[model samples]
Target: MTLTPQDRTIVEATQAGLPLVTRPFAVVAESLGLSEAELIDRLKQLKAQGVIRRIGAAPNHYRLGMTANGMTVWDVDDAVVDSLGEKVGALPFVTHCYRRPRALPDWPYNLFAMVHGETREEVIAKRVEISSLLGKACRAGDILFSTRILKKTGMRLRGKEG
Candidate 1:
């Protein structure tokens, strides 16, 4: 999508992340010489136009004492996967969940959910809860534990050449 010069400036200014302050938007607006209200309005417009999906905090799960992270994959019946996915996504222990296309013979999982806890055992326990919820609809499943942390970042705008 083509962003206006002003919107481009806003994206460039805040893409790294909003300022770490009580009033982050106000700080960003001040830096860009725009009022806080104007910045918020533009952001809302961008979201409505599908230029941005969402604006929210990306917390460090490890720092929050959730060191054990596992991505649980399930081979759920395609007929009910979407509905079951909604239920899995709503569960308190599931940080994120969604449905994916199966790779057939070798890999059959179609439902994916990320669970976090302080230990592998805890994560496995949470996985059991998910299995219980899936019931007979889920045929096979597995958990892939995270070995290291990776930086999570959003899209960034390139600087204009002078």
Candidate 2:
């Protein structure tokens, strides 16, 4: 991606958080030898170009009292999976919901939902609730708890793709 003068400053400064002060942008601008407006403008440009997907925090759910986090997969009917996937994704307890192509030979689950709770029982209860919501459509399924989290972070600006 082309890095215009302003693009370079916003990319570098925001690679770090929006500085942690009252005049954060001013501080970032100073460091880059540019004005606050210029820095802000660059961020706007980057967003418009779709070079920056989002500016937000990536919190570790497990560390934040969400001890029981599981990747629950379902063997759903192909005809209804697309619709059910959207419905399940709308639930509050389900943080991440997506469709993965069914695996061959050893695997068949195609729908995946991430469920999190404070304890194992709570997680199981939520799963049952989710299962009930699916109303027997989730013929077979499994949950794989998160044992450890390797890393969590926002976008990477030093590289082209993150």
lDDT of candidates 1 onward, in order: 0.92, 0.82
User: Which digits, one per residue and each the tens of the lDDT, describe model 2 over residues 2-110?
Assistant: 7775676568668757856888879888888888888778778788988887676656676798988898888898888989999889999998899999877678899
Best candidate per TM-score, number? 1
Error of 1 at 138 (Å): 0.8
Model 1 stretches with alpha carbons more than 4 Å out? 155-162
For every candidate, C-alpha RMSD to the true structure in Å: 2.2, 3.5
Clashing pairs in 2: none
lDDT tens digits, residue span 1-162, model 1: 799999999888877888788999999999999999999999999989998878888887888999999999999998999999999999999988988899878899999999999999999999999999999999999999999867566567898889
Runs in model 2 lying further than 4 Å from the true structure: 1-16, 32-34, 42-51, 154-162
Query: Candidate 1 versus the native: TM-score?
Result: 0.86
Q: What are the TM-scores, per candidate, against the unseen true structure? A: 0.86, 0.75
Looking at candidate 1, what is the lDDT of residue 3? 92
